[model samples]
Every structure is written in structure tokens, then in C-alpha cells.
Target: MIDLHGFGNQLLQGAVITVELAFASLIVGLILGLLGASAKLSSIKALQWIANAYTTIIRGIPELLTVLIIYFGATSVLMSVASLFGYEEYIEIGPFVAGVTALGLTFGAYATEVFRGALQSIPKGQHEAAVALGMGNVRKFYRIILPQVWRMALPGLGNLFLVLLKDTALVSVVGLDDIMRKASIAVSSTKEPFLFYSAAACMYLILTIISMVAVHYMEKKASRGIKRT
Candidate 1:
């Protein structure tokens, strides 16, 4: 049906953009998530407070609002700072940057909690044993702690990634050429809302199915050596 209207090519391009947006946001979110989890689990009270505040503020806000605010707010701030340096040209963030930053912030907030829980789930004795082996802190983390963290965190992180992938559609509002934006254009041109929207939905469903399958495979691989309860 989509191919009949010559909409297939446009939709395919949009899907590529959607995947790029999702992946860029995922990288940013994972980095932030790791840092946030470390900060929250640290002994320093100030670090803990800062991490808690980040997650609390981000999770409390709506994702759409977060995108709008980050895009407009960051643009205004950047322009103001540039003006102070006597470079008053209208500097603006691209839709990609804004979308990735917004979505990544939201993803990181939730991922922080997941990582924190995973890190805590590892028993204290494991660390003790690593030290008993005279392993350095870095080696202990890499060899002993990190692998279990990965195994434990994979499922939750995978779920968050699916949410992040869907959330990439919200970037359409900011003028990204994602599936939703292209579909909207097609609808306007053809005056066929149902066809284009349904096409868009199907594209998203395909992405979700593929992602779920990949996650399941990774989970099975990660579960090796663990006894099934």
C-alpha cells in the first residue's frame, strides 16, 4: 500500500534517520547513566544529591516538554553567551542535536536507576574476594564487577532502549525528518491521513520487533553460566 503511493522511498529514508537518532541518543544516555549511577552510589553526599536531583527532575517532566524546553532553552542560552563574546549571529542547534540531547537526558534518568539497582545487586563478598586475590581496583572492576553488572543490567537497559527508540518519533515535532514527520508530509500532500499514519505505525512496529528479537538473543547469551531458577 505504501509503495503504491511512492511513499516507500521517503519512509525508508525517514526510518534511517530514526535509527540514527535512536543510536546517538543511546550512546549519550549510556554514558550519562553510568556516571549518574556511580555518583548515586558513591560515598560523597554532594555527588549523591546531584545525581538524585538529575533523575528526579528529568523523570518528573514529560518527554515532549523536555524536548521543547531543551531545544528552545539551549538555543536561547547559546545565543546569549555568544552575544557576550561579540558573535551575535543567530546560532542554533540542529534538530538532531536537540532531539538527541532531550531524548538522551530522559533515557539517562531512568537508566540511572536501573544501573544503580544492578550495581547494588552484586554481593559485597565478590569485591572482598577480588581484593583477597590481590587484584587491583581497576582489574577487580573490569574482571569481576563489570561482567556481572552487564549480565544483570542488560534486560532493564534493553527495555529502556526500546522506549528510547519509540521516543525518537517525538523529534519529529522539532523538524527532524523522522518517520512521523515524513508521514505527516505525505498525509498533507495526498490528503490520506489513515494510509500514511498506518504506514508509519507499521514501520515503527517492525523496528520494535527487530529490537526485541536482538535483545532476547543478547539476554540468552548473557545468561550463560547462571543457574536457571
Candidate 2:
């Protein structure tokens, strides 16, 4: 065993950052995914085309490439603006922002398809009934469509979230000091790669277990009062 008492805190801190990144990305991703799905479902041809392209291109790209592109692209753009403003030094966007944006974009791409399919899975009769009962478009969507879509999308979203949690490890490539990067550092210092990596694995396993419990609770809550088909 390594001297975990003294040197383990760094790893713990990194793991915390990792979890925070995952949750933050998931939230942003969820919002973007819903918006993208709505755009895809819209009657506007251009909006639907744009949204479809976004999903297809993003889903096709490797996660690592996407992260690097977002990370470097964002910084480069900011730095350009800063230089024009007579600030010779670069305006820094930290690892957290880069990691969150990258991971969020990646998650959103997959989520767009999931949400679109879920929304489509809802019975058209529900919308028709709501309209017949004098519900406007907004009311119908919120009261009828949203509820059903959530129920249908929950499983797919949960699966995406689980994958998103694991992908937080990739942020380590950009020096985010997440669990994997910290584990690598620890291994270097202690010359115990297996021990540190195993610890990291344990942390990931714990996260998945907790997520499972939460997802199950949410599923039951969302499906409440709905009868079997």
C-alpha cells in the first residue's frame, strides 16, 4: 500500500473535480439536447436541417477530438479578441470551463437523438385531445407532451449520463486534474500504478452505483399514475 494518509488528498480532490465536471456537463447537455430536439421537430425546414447536422456531425466525431477542438478553439478565439483589445497576454479559460463545454457538447449530441425519438414516441392522440380541450400549443406541449417525453426519454438519458460520467476521465488529457490525471500523478510519485488506478476504478464504481439509485427513483417518480399499456 502507498502512503495514502499523506498523499491521498490530492487524488480525492481530483475525484471531486471529476464528479463536478460530470454533473455540470450533464445539466448543460440536457438543456442543449432539449433545445436541439425541439428545433429538429419544428416545422421550419432550416432549423430542422441545422439541428440534424449538429447531431450527426457531433455523434460521428470521436469524443477525444471533440474535446480537444472545443478546448483549443475556445481559447484561441478568446485570445484573438484579447490581443485586438491591446491585452498582449492571453485571456485564460480554465480547464474546468473547457472540460465542461467539451463534455457537455458531446453529451448533447447523443441526447438530441434520444429526446427527439422520445418526443416522437408520444401518441399523437394526446396532443389532439389537448387541442380539442382548448389547450394552446404551449399548454399542450408543457402539460401533455413534456410529461410523456420525460417518461419515454428517462432510460436513454440515464444511460447517456452514465456514459458521460465515465467520459469525464478524458478531460484529464487537457490537464483538468480529474480523477484519471490525478491517478497518473499519484502512480508516478508512489511508483504504484496498480494501486492508484485501482482506487480510481473504485471511485468510478461508486459513482455508477449512486447514479443507478437516483435514476431508479426518478423513473418511478416520472411514471407515477401511468397505467400499463
Q: In model 1, how large is the Cα lDDT of residue 185?
A: 92
Model 2 TM-score, all chains together: 0.90
Question: Where's the lowest-lDDT run of ten residues in candidate 1?
Answer: 1-10
* lDDT of each residue in 164-228, candidate 1, tens digit only: 99999998998999999999999988999998899999999999999999999999898899999
Output the lDDT of residue 217, model 1: 95
How many Å off is the CA of 156 in candidate 1?
Answer: 0.8
lDDT values, one for every candidate: 0.93, 0.88
lDDT of 2: 0.88
Candidate 2 residue lDDT tens string, 1-229: 2457355788788878988999999999999899999999999999999998988888888888878887888888888888888988866767788888888988898999999999988888887899899999989889889888898899999999999999999889988998899998888878988888888898899899999999999999999998867
RMSD of candidate 2 to true structure, Å: 2.8
